[model samples]
Target: MNESAATITKPTPLLIELRGVTKIYGSGAAAMSALRGIDLHIDQGDFVAIMGPSGSGKSTCMNILGCLDTPTDGDFFFEGVEVGRMNRDKRALLRRHYLGFVFQGYNLLNRTSALENVELPLIYRGVPRAARRARAQAALAAVGLAGWENHTPGELSGGQQQRVAIARAIVTEPRVLLADEPTGNLDTARSREVMELITTFNREHDLTVLMVTHEPEMAAYAKRQVHFLDGLIVPGPNQGGDA
Candidate 1:
């Protein structure tokens, strides 16, 4: 195609898009609307942070973006595919292939070694044992936990556990990383360390990152910030600019 034609025909795919999304818990009088007509789009390779106080619908938005839950109304599109009405198994598959999750609590099996914990996703995907071990080892090393591969969660510090959790999240080489309060449990120093790792991954791998954080400093680590208030997105100067 010619330059003009190419420019006109080219399509920019969004990593995640929410069009008039509304999430409500319960029904009728008891219903609690967690999200109110959210319209958001995250482009590929963008690092966006969702910030809001508790009950502001940030977590609800994250859940919808992560495929953990569906919107009560409107649509959610991931990589140009509608996912709002996907079956549980399809949504699980979508998450496995396209998204990774990191959480504040650093969810890890207490008795499992770091390497084993990181290998869980690959195991679920039925990767070969040898490949799983190799990939898990590399992931752990990437997160600066090279020598801690054999250590269980109980044997690691809070920061170390969080590193392991991050290792696990990226082991599958997902296209997007959803981190909800990733640094919530860490001290200032540890939080910075974790953010540095996350930033490195985003830059080096061109990974799209969507994070939910209440701390302004944490949100500042992201390239853009989207604020939420009263179940709706709040317009701000940093809506899609440098946070």
Candidate 2:
């Protein structure tokens, strides 16, 4: 099999889809467009990395995909549901129900124990206390953090903190995992560990992962890579067309 074939097999029915997604800031001639009519789809179990230089609009795309920001004009469908049309409360509900996020900084609360951090989402969803604790512990154990649950972020190393973050993000068994520069702050060894953890979850749990990164090495871990240039989607040197 070819190298590309060794990576992503083929596109199935997409869990994340975007059409004519545009984000414009400002007005008139001074109007700046962050994303310009981008069309993309990512199937279930696909691990995609979005790459671009600074100001290339990849970050904006990440925000839109994560439901943290709405597009200025366009249609976005998540798991066949029209998410772009939902109100703020509904959007929050959808995010809580179907999306998980990890970031460069591993934003675990300083005051909360790792276990509590993982349980926060379940609490927000009104999960019963006992069930929430059980699931949170299970998620942490999945990430190889079984004995570290009582530690706080300050007590863990960079890699450990990120594992806790990943544990928190996946505890809900979200439909999609959105990671923005997940290893930007880690050392090479730590970054590789984090990427491997993510890849394992993608392969074993069938989680759809969309990650944003500028590093080619990091992007290589994904099943497909999409490049952006000047606020538009451009074909990356390694991308296998619109698969």
Candidate 3:
């Protein structure tokens, strides 16, 4: 099938599926299991929050779901394609085409302007200079940073810097956004502002959001919430968790 035709024939609903997923570190009796038989599915356009306390394995699960790590056992399927068994190069290609990430630290290079930071992903994707700049500018504009593209991270407030990071994450318009403690370092008000932007992106753009957070209020913005304990996910309140 041609590329466009092949894409058109793919299933539309389920975006991510993990079956009997497990991660093990070390070896012999000293080994540690991160995720224990995780079976889950996340649909396209769904907003989900994964909540847990420290050492609950949520981080491992998030890493696996984001294609940052592969499971020692079990299978991972993204858009009906089995990715867990893929090699590193294949996984990297999938990540470039399918996922965007936002993390706690802004992670912007000090010397780079906001626009340049946002353009990094496109550069990796082999987008041309002119088109990459245009798309980066539009993404910044979407995040309300139109005139501040020339500003470096140091010149911007914490909130503005975070927004710039968000713009960078969304610039590619990937199928899924994996957010790990996106607002953990921000003050309450700034946290709210960032959350509003994330929710707005999910609501209006149909971006599939899978966010890992320890805060109950942050999870409340998501349509579904899952909590992890002792490396297993258990049923919990939609937003707030014991964490």
Candidate 4:
């Protein structure tokens, strides 16, 4: 066999990356820094937990990662594309196509059924009614809420509502799932159920996951945890303690 023929080269793109990231609110003396000169990387299919105390910039970082907010300084790359430099419309499009978000509040439509709420993203993307309905139903089933599709949030328990939210997030088949305190509103048993579902989705679908959690038990579900304090990453073993 020829040496040239045997040679193989391929590079895996990082699903998310931040370099020298900084976030500042206001300006001058009144300005408050959220994230300061931070560098972080997450590859495809990796589960990362971002843990930090209140006002430690973890939320800011999650916003930037989810394309919900732009950094005041430095670069943010998503799947080899520079998201920080993209215009607002481009950023919006990027988020619509590549990102899914699950929040502590389980931002589902209060008046809508679980299936309809799960279909909202697809509806925004101009997916036809039939296709969106089918996909939404499938997503609901994936989250173990097959029979709850017709129920509204008010009719479900906290865990069920969160399950609907997860179904909505995954219905789009996004490349990255940004979960901000996803289990924050659930009880211990419910939290375990939610985390197990998330873990299964991450492993079976090969989805990249980035979660922000103040609870150590919640963060333990992730493969690796990165701690933040006073706007910077806390290096060493101390990083694993309570946020």
Of the candidates shown, which would achieve the greatest lDDT relative to the real structure? 2
Task: Give Cα-based local distance difference scores for all models.
Answer: 0.88, 0.89, 0.87, 0.87
Screening candidate 4 with a backbone cut-off below 3 angstroms (N, C-alpha, C), the clashing residue pairs are: none
Candidate with the greatest TM-score versus the true structure: 2
Per-candidate TM equals 0.92, 0.93, 0.92, 0.92
Cα lDDT for residue 8, model 3? Answer: 40
lDDT of 1 by residue, 1-243 (tens): 012321332343566788999999999999999999999998877899899889999999999899999899999887688999899999999888778899999999989999999999999888999999999999999999998999999999999999999999999988889999999999999999999999998877777799999899988899889988889988654444322
TM-score, predicted candidate 4 vs. hidden true structure: 0.92
What's the lDDT for candidate 4?
Answer: 0.87
Worst 10 residues of 1 by lDDT: 1-10
lDDT of 4 by residue, 18-73 (tens): 99999999999999999998899887777888988899999999999988899999
Clashing pairs in 1: none
User: After best superposition, candidate 3 residue 4: deviation in angstroms?
Assistant: 11
Over 1-243, each residue of candidate 3 has an lDDT whose tens digit, in order, gives 113422442344787999999999999999999889888889877889898889989999999988889999999999898999888898898888888899898888897899999999999999999999999999999988999999999999888988998999899888888999989989989999999999998877778899999899998898888899889888785534432
Model 3, total clashes = 0
Span of 10 residues, lowest total lDDT, candidate 2: 1-10
lDDT score for residue 137 of model 4: 97
TM-score of the candidate numbered 1? 0.92
Q: How many residue pairs clash in each candidate?
A: 0, 0, 0, 0
